[model samples]
Target: MREEKGVIIRTLQEDINNLKIEQASTLHQLSSTLSHLSSTLSQVADLQHEQNALRQELRKEQNQRLTIQEEVNRLKSKGCQCDNSSRNSTLLPHDIQTVKEAITFDLQLEMKQQNDSIMSEMSRMEKDVRDVKAKIRATAMTISGLVSSVSDLQTQIYFSAGTIRDVNKQWKTNEIIVFPHVLANVGGGYDASSGVFTVPKSGVYVLTCFLSTHSSSMYAKLILNGNPVVGITAVTNDVSDVDTGGNAMVSRFQQDDRIWIQFYIGHFLWTMSDASVSTFSGFLL
Candidate 1:
C-alpha cells in the first residue's frame, strides 16, 4: 500500500510538470504572434499616414489650379476691345486719325499689360507645381524609410512605384489620362494632331506631347481635355528651325480622364510636314 501511494504521487508530479511545459510553449508562441502583429500594424499606420499627407498635398494643388483658372478667365474677359471713349468726342478727319492712332496705342498697351499678367500667373503656377512636386518627393522619402524599417519585420511588404511609358500603340484622340489614372485614347491619330486622351487606371501619371512648326507667327497650343494648356511658337520661317521639334505637353490624369492639345492652326503649317499628326506619350506614377 505504501509503494502504490508513492507511485501515484510520482505520476501526479510528472503530469504537473508536463502541463507547465505546455503553458510555457503557449506563452512563447503568443508572444511571437503579438510581436508580428504589432509590426504589421505599424506598417499599416505608416501607409495611412502617407496617404493622408498625399491628400493634403493634393488639396493644395487643386486650390492652386482653381486660382489659376480664375485668373485665366479674368484675363480672357479683359481680352476684349480696349475702350478709349474719353478721347473720342472731337469729330474731324484729323481728329479721327488721331483717335485711331490713340486707340491703336491703347490696344498695344493693353496687350502688354495682358502679357505681363499672363507671365505673372504662369510664374505662380510653376511655383505651386514645384511645391507639389517637392511634397511628393518628401512622401516618397517617408515611404522609403517606412519600407526599410518594415523590411526586417516582414519581407513581403515592399511596394514597387515607378513610371512606365508607351504601354500601348493604339491611342485614341481626345483621351486624357490624369494622375492616379491609367492612360486612355479618345480618338485615333498619330503625331501632333489634337484629340482627347483617356485614363485607364487610377494613379498619378506624367504626360508629354510633341508638336513642331516651320513658319514664323505659327504657334501650337496644347489642350488637356478641351482646356487650353501649353503653347509653343517658332521664331523663324525655316522648316528645320521649328521642324524636327515636337511640342511636349504634360498633365496629371485620373481614371477615365481625358486630355488633348489643339494648335491655333492659323500659322502652324508644319503639323503634317514631318508627321501625320501630333503624338502623345505619358507614364504611370
Candidate 2:
C-alpha cells in the first residue's frame, strides 16, 4: 500500500508540474500577441502622420497659387493705368506702342511661369494622393485581420472552483462530490450547482482535481461521463494528520461530454479559514 501511495503521489506531482509548463506557454503566447498589436498600432500612427503632412502641403500649395494670382492682377492694373497716361500725354505713337508691347511680353512670361509651376506641383500632388490612398487601404486590411485574430484568441474555455463552504461532509462510495463554489466559468461550460463541467467544444483539455482530508483517509476519482479516468488517495496515519492530494490530466473530449470528481471513500474536513481547501479546474488547450 505504501508503494502504491508513493506512485500516486509522484503521478500527481508530475501532472501539476506539466500544468505549470502549459500555463507558462499560454502566457508567452499572450505576450507575443500584445507585442504584435503594439507594432501594428505604431504603423497606423505613422500612416496617419503621413496623411496629415500631405494635407498640409496641399493647403500650402493652394495659398501660394492665390498669392501669385493677386500679383498678376496688380501688374495688369498698373499696365492699364500706364496706357491711359500715354494716350493723354504728348508721347510719340511708336514709343507708346513699344512700351505697351514690353508690358504685354512681361505679363505673358509671368503667366507662363506660374502656369508651368502649378501644373508640375499638381502632378506631383496627384501621385502623392494615389500613394496615400493605397497605403490607407492596406492599413485598413491589416487592421481587419488583426481584429479577427483578437476575436479568435478571446474565445476561451476554462473554469475554477470558488471558496467552498466548510461542511465536513462524509461521502459514501461512488458519490459525486459537488463543489458548490464557482470562481470562474468562462464559456459557461462548468455548472457549479451540478459540480460537473460540460465540454463546450471538441478539443484537448486539461482537467485538475484536488482534495484535503483530516484525520481520515480519502479516496477519490476523476470521472469522465460516469467512468473513472484517474484516482487520488489522501491518507492520514494519525488523528491529527491532515493530507492533501491533487491530480491533473490532459485529455480529449467531444462537445457535451461531462467531467466531475467522485468520492470513493473518505470524510472531507473543510473550513472557511483553511488554506488548503479542495478545488477543481479545467481549460481547453
Candidate 3:
C-alpha cells in the first residue's frame, strides 16, 4: 500500500507538469497572434491615412475645376450679354411688341437714309470714274511725258541698286558709329550710322532694318523713323540656345523721314547693319 501511494503521487506530479507546459505553449501562441494582429492594424491605419489624403486631393481638384467652370460661365455670359436669369425674366406681351415696333421704325429710317446717301455717292463716283477714263485715254498719246512726270514724283529716292552700303566694320558693344554716305540717286545722301536715311523721293516709302546681336546676353532695339520696336531679350542663360540670332523690324516712311536702329541696353553688336528701301513706287495704299 505504501508503494502504491508513492506511485500515485509521482503520477499526479507528472500530470501537473504536463498541464503547465501546455498552458505555457498556449500563452506563447496567443502572444504571437496578438503581435501579428497589431502589425495588421498598423498597416490598415496607414492605408486609411493614404485614402484620406487622396480624398482631400480629389476634393481640391474638384474645387479648382468648379472655380474654372464658374469663371468660364461668367466670361461666356458677359460675351453674349445674356444669362439664363435674364432670358427667363418676365415681360408683358404688349410692352414687348411696343419696344420691337419702335426698334423697327428707327432701323427703317436709318436704312432709308443710308440707301439715299449710298445712291448719291454712287452717282458721284460713277461720274468721277468716267472722267478718269476720259483723262487716261486723252493722255495716252502723251504717255511718255506723263510717265516721266509721274516717275519724277515717285522716284524721290532711287534705291534700285547700291542703296544699302555695308561699312564692313565689326560693330562691337556700346558703339554708336556713323554709317557710310550713299550717293542719292537724285540729290541727297543717306548716312545710316547717324540713323538718317534721307528719302530723296517725294512719294511714300517702306523702310526695314535687319538687325541682330552677338551670342552674349543681349537685346536689340530697332528705331525706324523715330519709332521704336523693341527686340527680344535673353531672360535665361539658355536663351541663346533658343534664339542664336537677333530680331528684325520694318516700318513705312515718307519723304525726308529718318530711320535708325539702336540698343536698349548696351549689347554686343554683330556684323550686320544693312538697310534697304522697301518700296518707293506705289501710292499710299
Candidate 4:
C-alpha cells in the first residue's frame, strides 16, 4: 500500500510539470504572434502616410495642369484679326508645341516616380508575405487592404494630334477628320489611321480641338460614340488672313468608347506650310 501511494504521488507531480511546460510554451507563442502583429501594424501605418503624401502630390500636379490649360485657352481666345494678329497666330502653334512638350516631360517624370513606388512597395510586400507565410491567416486581411490602396493610384492617359496635310473639299459633312500626325499619344489610345481615340479605361476626360482656316469658314464637331458633344468654327474672309477657333469639354467615357473629330460644316481645313494648325487633344483626368 505504501509503495502504491508513493507511485501515485510521483505520477501527479509529473503531470503537473507537463502542464506547466505546455502553459509556458503557449505564452511564448502568443508573445511572438503579438509582436508580429505589432510590426505589421507599424508597416501599415507607414504605408498610409506615404499614400497621403502621394495624394497631395497628385493634387498639386493636377492643379499645374489646369493652369497650363487655362493659359492655352487664353491664347486661343485671341483670334487672328490684323497683320499683327496673324503674326501672333503663327506663334500660337509653337506655343502649343511648347506646352505639349512640358506636359509630356511632367507626365514622364510622374510615371517614373509612380512606377518606382509601385515596385518598391511590391518588393516590400513580397518580403512581408515570405516572412509571415506561417501566419498567412492572420495577415491576409492587412495585405489585401494594402493592395487595394495601391491600386487606386492609377497612371494618367493623354494624346495630342494634328492634321498632317491640307484637308481640302474632300471632307464632307459628318465625315471623321483624321489627324494623321500624332504629336503625342502617351496611352496609345489614338489611332492615326482611323482618326479615333478608343477609351483605354473608364474615367472623366478633357477633350479639346483647335482649327485654323484661311479665306474660308470651317466648322468641326467633337463626336463621342456617334453623338456630337461640341462644335468649333474658324471663319476667315481675307485670303491672307488666318483665323483660329477651338472648343474644350469635360465628359465621362467608358472603356472602349470612341471619340473623334467630325467635319460638321466647313469648306476646308488648312494647315501652315511649316506647322500644323488643326489639332485635337484629350487627356484622362
Per-residue accuracy of model 1 over 61-139 as CA lDDT, tens digit each: 6566566666555644443222343246344233444555565566556655755665565566556556555655655
- Which is better, 2 or 3, measured by TM-score? 2
Instruction: Give me the runs in candidate 2 sitting further than 4 Å from their true place.
Output: 1-149, 272-276
Clashes of each: 52, 0, 6, 0
- Candidate 3 residue-wise lDDT, 1-285, digit = tens: 224324533554564466556556655655555555565556556555655665565566556656655655565555344334446655423244345446556655655565565556556555655654555454453444444544443433332112243333444543433434332323443553454456544444433233333344555444545566544343324424222233333345556765444545524333323543211111121
Pairing residues by index, what is the TM-score of model 2? 0.49
Candidate 3's error at 213, in angstroms?
A: 2.4
RMSD of 2: 9.2
**TM-score (all chains, Cα) for each model:** 0.29, 0.49, 0.32, 0.50
Candidate 4 residue spans exceeding 4 A from truth: 1-38, 41-146
lDDT minimum window of 10 residues, candidate 2: 1-10
Report how far off residue 189 is in candidate 3 (Å). 4.6
lDDT of each: 0.45, 0.71, 0.44, 0.71
- The model with the greatest lDDT is 2
What would the C-alpha RMSD of candidate 4 be, to one decimal place? 45.9
